[model samples]
Target: MPENRTEISELGEFGLIERLNQDVILRNPSTLKGIGDDAAVIEAGDHVKVVTTDLLIEGVHFDLSYAPLTHVGFKAVAVNVSDIAAMNAIPTQITVSIALSNRFSVEAVEDLYAGINAACEHYGVDLVGGDTTASRGGLVISVTAIGEAQKDQVSYRSGAKVNDILCVTGDLGSALIGLQILEREKQVYLANPDMKPDLEKYDVVTGRQLKPDARMDIIHELREMDIVPTSMMDVSDGLASEIFHICKASNVGALIYEDKLPIDKQTFDTAVELNLDPITCVLNGGEDYELLFTIDQKDFAKLEKHPDIHFIGHMTKAEEGKFLVTKSGTAVQLKAQGWKHF
Candidate 1:
């Protein structure tokens, strides 16, 4: 008889994570959270530390043909920090490890670190330690970020309650549209090396793709307002997919409004130019790095006058199921078709 070989593709990314996490047992009393959240929470004396890591590979997470090494390094750090922010923590330190091929020279590595250093300064994080190794494959970067917050200030995906207001920061879908523009330009250049890429017109979208800023600004403002969100997560995945995560973890449902979804004018225009539905892009596009969170109804007034935060929807009973109330007054089931590594 043949040994049963389970294909990873059949399980998908989240499903695989779930399957592997099933048997893992947390034995330490200090391990406040192990898996199944944006970041792991470890108990500290008066405060808790939030830890998160991310892996970015060449040709997979980025294309060196278009993406500058500097931007890649910056993004690598920003993503991990974003995860920390999702837990309502202030990032303090990061350790960066990189695997390099011969293709990258010392100057190339310096350029990469230039971006990394810039991000470290930008986010007020220290580059405490890291590792380096040779790789036959292209560049690979791994970043582990440590953040601090009061034990009570930590937010988890499982904390959302029924009737809590759903809020999102910045805009959505711009990064995905920017990726499309970059890819289109890459193809154009490949077909004709003499032609220069005309990216000045698409600068906003392209910038969003090349260098995404984590919404740490919003996190700081939330702290100032003394509004600890009921639940939170960064929108590294698509808005809808992240909503699904919050709902599943919190054992609740969400009803987001179509008209309330935020999209930049440039993102909308470019998505249409690419023959993609803007709404779909906003819902399913990934890598925006914005914050998606829910707050108690009482806290809504505190953020209502805020410029960047948009109140899109509210949580509902688990039996209500997740849905999007479309502009046409149709309530449709929300789907998670975001970025899938598998």
Candidate 2:
């Protein structure tokens, strides 16, 4: 008889997280939130601190063949900041740790830091401290961001209620489409060294992939408007997958309108050029780094006039089940087929 063994693939990413978090206990009263939400909340004197961290492995999260080191550095910071934004907090500091192989030179590291510093300036965060180590495999970057918000203003994934309006910021699917384009062009170049990548027309999608701007602007705007979302999270995963997370956390279902999904014209056209369904890309594509949140029904009118925010759906009773109302008025079950590392 073989010794008992379980594969990580048996439990998907979320399932693995749940299983691993099952026995974990919060020992301190200051730990307001633990492993479930985007970031863990720690009680401070007057306000609360939201802390989140993200680890990016070279080939797994980014490909150096097409991805610039500068963009990678910036993206590493942005992703962590996006998690802080998900908690409805303003990021103040970040610590970036990197593991480097001899393949990189001092100039290369400087270029990477240039982007990291640019992101810190862009987001108004200070690079307090981090660790540097040697890597046997490839470059690895881990960023931990700390943000602040009043206890009353912090939003959690569990705060959404039935009938709350579901909102998403900016466009979706562009990053995925951009990634596809980069991979396609890389393949072309690998096949023939003489071929120069024609990436000018694909700027929007590629930019979304190379460097994603976290939705900190929306957080600031919401603060200005005095609107704290009932529930929120950044769309690091695909739209459908993220909706599933919100639903599971809030114990509610969602019914988003297909017509209401935001897809940029360039992304739509390029997806068709690649023989991909635009809507499916919007729903299942990941790495957009946009914000998906729910506002109380009464708060809907305030954000309605805002240009970037899109009202795509409303929360429903969990028993109602999650579905997407197609353009033809047919409700279809949503599948979480987004990015799967395993």
Q: What C-alpha lDDT do the candidate models reach, one value each?
A: 0.96, 0.96
Candidate 2 weakest lDDT stretch, 10 residues: 1-10
Q: Against the hidden reference, what TM-scores do the models get?
A: 0.99, 0.98
Candidate RMSDs in order? 1.0, 1.1
Candidate 2 lDDT, 1-342, residue by residue in tens: 669888889998878988988999889999999898999999999999999999999999999999999999999999999999999999999999999999999999999999999999999999999999999999999999999999999999999999999999999999999999999999999999899999999999999999999999999999999999999999988999999999999999999999999999999999999999999999989999999999999988888899999999999999999999999999999998989998
lDDT of 2: 0.96
Q: Give one digit per residue, the lDDT tens place, for model 1 in 1-342.
A: 669988899999988999999999999999999998999999999889999999998998999999998999999999999999999999999999999999899999999999999999999999999999999999999999999999999999999999999999999999999999999999999999999999998999999999999999999999999999999999988999999999999999999999999999999999999999999999999999999999999998899999999999999999999999999999999999979987
- Alpha carbon deviation, residue 144, candidate 2 (Å): 0.4
Q: What TM value does model 1 have? A: 0.99
Instruction: Give the backbone clash total of model 2.
Output: 0
Instruction: Give candidate 1's root-mean-square deviation (CA, Å).
Output: 1.0
